[model samples]
Target: MSAEHHPRDRRTARVGLVLFLLTAVLYVATAGYQRVHIDVLSADVGAWRIAATGEPSIDGLDTSSINRSRVDLFSTVHDGRTVIARSPGVVAAGVPAYALRQWVTDAGPDAEDFTTVPPTVTAALLTALSVLLMWGALLRLTTRRRATAAALVFALATPVWSVAADGMWTHTLTVLGVSGMAFGAARDRWLLVGLFGGIAVWGRPHMALVAAALALTCAWVRRRPGIVARVAAVGATLTAGASLWSYWLYGRWSPSGGYAPAPYLSRGAGAQYEFNQTLGGLLRNEAAMWLSLDRGILVWTPVVVVLLPLLVQTWRSQPAWTRALFLAGVGYTLFQGAVAPFHGGDGIYGYRHGLEFLACATPALVVATARVGRRTRVVLTVVIGVQLAAFSLGGVLNRPTLSFRHHWNDNAFVSGLRDVPLLWAWVAISVALVLLLSRMFLREGAREA
Candidate 1:
């Protein structure tokens, strides 16, 4: 086994390094260019505004404030009872608070004096970390070479990478948390896994399930009575400590602190409604709302198509225990979609609620895609290349507003690129990708005995 495995492992490592390098190039190119033109300080300026003030919440800063207003982090709400969490307010989690406090002491309410560089830099760094984690997780699941290819595809994935570069939402942080947990699990480092799980929840309350699921997995994996007991004790203790810290801030021990249901049943109910609700009933309506908000996916159908097969491959994988973690990631993301209001269909960046799942499922794409025949691999690569080119164009130039139109947010480069010539280009690119990816499906199916 090692004889065959050795070469494959080396190749995978090389692929992973290449993928990392490519991602770095894309990120630096985009962020550096963007910073020059748009003032890096002003990109996701709301987050910085929030950090400067002592707001412990972010509930109030919806997409409505996108281009219209500047959020004041230090301003008090009516009656001085509460502070908002948005452009003007900070969520006070982990390092953001300490950083903000120090800045305030050093600079004093200058509005422009907050720690701007670190957050944006951190956002970019998190993207790199997430990609690395995905690569590692995929490596654990498959041959080294295949894992590296998967990481490359994931890093360059149109939707995932595009969002990573924009640095608009908290989804990046959540991605880091989820990816970290996955890495921990694959390595059997329950303690580190538990720590990441805690961080994931800390980053976003709705993600609390990730940590809980890890804890359970730890117990099951180390099932001997003594080892199980020890794992459980350590896992529970870590989780409790993090939960307590959160509760201390929001007076509730939850990720979505204020929004979490009274008893937690509602959270489960929301997930069920999303998964099982009838097409003609509440579920359909919910889906429609999500679609409206996530128009980006609608506009970019290629990325959308990849999601189904990605899920299918995971569903068919062996070992019920292994599959449960993947399912939990899906369930939690779908739950977010069900419960979250249609901030445009779930909020700001199309399908924002499901971004969490996208992050978790992304590694699977690389693994599944790489396992295809050579010609098929070429086709898939072409398609992904086209998608990236299309997305980059859309991002860099004017494009017909595909999503978030209510906000008049249109900086997309594809607006002009979507003309007849570009349309044909997109079509050719897509056909090639589909052909390759289809071969991948056939190969995986053939092996499914």
Candidate 2:
């Protein structure tokens, strides 16, 4: 049946719109409260703004007015001139906002103390829209309420909240693209699936794994012939365009020209040499990524720990495409941990490198947990409460930086929550509310059953 004829699809889109608006408002309010501007967290936004002003290289641009440390984020071109080393897709994405900021300020995009509000808020809106798309995808396989719940968890309990709301980081755009790809795939919108997938790859080369997985799933698992051709066409076109731009900027067709020392060498010979000692070292890093309290995945969002079991339980019942998407998330996470130079994503909170997987696989997780027993659902709710508490408190208290060691200790839980009595009170309230909601939902589900 067509999506237009499905009542669930209509409801899902409506709920998605509400969630999107709520997310946008929350992000904008937070940005305002924080008095956000182009800071280190959004150095790329600043770089893009400069690029929008027609300056290809920031080599001689006076950055003294801005945070000098942000300049370090850019890459030195082959000619020894400093340039934004990251992909231009993000810069291109922010052009509309940059233009708006210029008009608002009535000054050059390079004006000192120029506000980053436009681009930052634009990024947040994009993220909210992505979350909406993810919710719509979840709705295809689960109840509307369950899909709404998943969207809430994604927007509130995950790093998606902190990271996307902060600025136009590459991950922010990548999440939007990935979520759109998943939504399109769920609805058999092959063209949109390929389009968003290609956009994601353009935003972050590593996301090619996700794009390829989606394309292959449609072609092999779903047996959709046209999907492969569409994906390849879009992917090839974007990659070729990006390559040409890279050649112009770096004199080589390298997309990662900005990440100096190259990804492989960035971690230095000690780590690379030790990792080559055996595959064990790579596995150890992956384990550490999930188990290390300092920056571990579960340590930051314990709800995911609960979701894992639920996901495994519902594996057999899931659609082949959903299963493929879940594997894609796992593959991307493993790939990032094993190969990426910055395993933890350096400056963000809570395994930012894994945000794409976490956000993209959320629909699969919601579907997996939809039929879980009441007790299990209650437990999941509590875990989500704790995750929300941690994310909320940490976002407010922790210093936003590349390294957390300075502000967080070996035990992030203790360090983050120890001294904040008000935050503890908030956590108590949040848990109680979660339990009440869980009971209501379980009762409602029982009545329907």
Candidate 3:
């Protein structure tokens, strides 16, 4: 912000832009519908339909292009006619891409399929921007050199690539929101934190607690009630707006809308959902989220291992708002893990539920990046090397069908390696490359220090 940092900051911005383009291309290229086409496909249909017609329901259109089931259970609900059910944010977010796809393809208003690049590109671009914002967040608490290293790991080696970038899932929007929170909270920009906090809820309704955590923690830590009040005002406006949108689309005040199987909570819909948390389910699921190879956050993102040793020190080192942000991530993870379907569905490579925790930990991780030893760097590189090879084989280059067709207990990365000979080669080459890069990073960090 000062004159002393202007040149370097601009350089960092340029570097981030380059990374943005590179990441976007990879994300879009590797994206495939697999079993999740309807997720974003419905969004495109909804946005396009809204543009051409006033009606929200796709009653007359042929929806076979997206392979939408004639009577799918969760994705849609029947009132009088079938609706292409999706979260309000998901539908709204894809409007620009749907428009662009239509313009470039010269498609008519009647067209239902949006393709060439899947409409999920909206999620991809947003996730890429989060990487740049992550770099900025790191710079707030650490040197540029450390910030770049951590941001690169975030982009390439984390679930931002394997899970969020795979499709237009909630993880895409949720990561973006939390990344904004990290950027704002690190600098005590209460309003920015609050604004993104509200947006995070739109990404996933359960994430309402995230904004609540940030607001209350900021109030408690900074003890600036007036500024925190501004945070609440901005966040409340967005929250109210999203609720209105939900009601208009879903015809109910409930955030879950018509997604539930039952008509209402009074009629046994509560049985389908678990408000009464099982102690065993909570303990088992939460532990598995961090420790299990099948869908553990650490397994997919071993780079976070470095943060473990530094959490306490960095917790002491960071400001109150930052610490509060990380604690909020902890609470978010626990609550989500408690209520989510066991071990998450058997569709993805890593644990999508753990993303916010990783995002919120950025400040502590950035502070800790400076302290990691060279041996630890190479060792972490080795862990990441195997992870990249596994993810590329299982997640990007192909879908995680082994888990889907068989069971969630199966590790998609391991299955990818076992079934594909090419992945063995990928592991051989990538491990060497990451090791070489680790040495270069070590030298650069030493010179900068």
Candidate 4:
């Protein structure tokens, strides 16, 4: 029988379809009707333009058609010819969408006047599909309601929603790749797992950590020589292919492309780099990313705070292979935090890079919540409710400048806090409420235990 004809596969497909439709509608509604411009697309889309048209250089592409800093981010002057500085994975991902846009809209490649709505909508749909993949994976380990809730949290209550729904950033593709790997692991399909892991690394080189972690976990779990060899061989081939492509394009084998050399080497760069390289600075930034109201992950999605306790409980109950799979998120987090830029995601909604970790960790969270007590559930409900309200209010406050370009110094959340003093007061109150509820939930769990 074909794979799609399998009862489990059919049910998974139906669930995925429903989730994809729901998330796509929500994203379109939230985006409103504005013809928003996305700045990050310059690198991904510009590269797409070059590849699609068989042009080696983006020099004559209209300057206004791309992001203002297209030259700096997308391409560089290499021996008098322009060369794309970004990895090709994301650009390749956009090819089908770009082709469809051209076929349906009768649009020509006008590099100077690229619109954001079409590509942004395409990316949002892709992100919705990722949520579906994550939801399907969670179902293997939890009840239907709990799996749905986890998927919803990953899609709406977290930074993944805001960042991935907005534009064609590499992070959206990374989420899809991570979630696909999770789904493959849940189904015990080692080949699928290896393929998704390879795709993740193709999208973002750092994701190799996630891929390697998953590959090792599967090999250890099955303990079959044939499976282990197949997974290793496939993964190595895909990753090596990507590296070779990078070398061919930029004369370098770096996974991040040749945009900015020695990005991880902070030594002698400046005081910021010097501080970021220190262990003390790394820990400080990690704390700030989780707890600080300005751009912390928990600040935007207090519901995720439950994951800490859930992780502890789940770790004890889950098998060693399962634990290793979940730890991919932890490994990715440490790697990203250690080498991330000074501002951490440069002023997006929350810690955008962390969204990939959150995606990988969602299945474990679903399992953890499956058998929780009533008190824990109540606290989680309250936390989710509060997060929804906070995000709604933030949408109103930062409506005008909520796109890919607004990061770091130009972050919309920071600007909202500065413009509206009352927003800070509201945030403080919300933070306190979440903390109190979390404490209550932990105490209740402890008592029950």
In model 3, pairs of residues that clash are: none
lDDT for each of the candidates?
0.50, 0.67, 0.68, 0.64
In model 3, where is the ten-residue run with the lowest total lDDT? Answer: 260-269
Total residue pair clashes for candidate 4:
5
lDDT of 1 by residue, 55-80 (tens): 44334444333333343332223233
Best-to-worst ranking by lDDT? 3, 2, 4, 1
Please report how far candidate 1 places residue 230 from its true position, in Å: 7.4
Decide which is better by lDDT, 1 or 2. 2
Off by over 4 Å in 4: 1-13, 28-39, 68-73, 104-106, 225-227, 259-261, 269-272, 319-321, 345-347, 392-449
Specify the poorest-scoring 10-residue window by lDDT in model 2: 32-41
Candidate 2 Cα lDDT to native:
0.67
* Residue 402 CA displacement from its true place in model 2, Å: 9.1
Supply the TM-score for candidate 3: 0.87
User: What are the per-residue Cα lDDT tens digits for candidate 3 across 229-294?
Assistant: 877787777778777766777776544433442431222345544532466655776777777777
Q: Candidate 1 at residue 304, lDDT?
A: 37
How does candidate 4 fare on TM-score?
A: 0.80
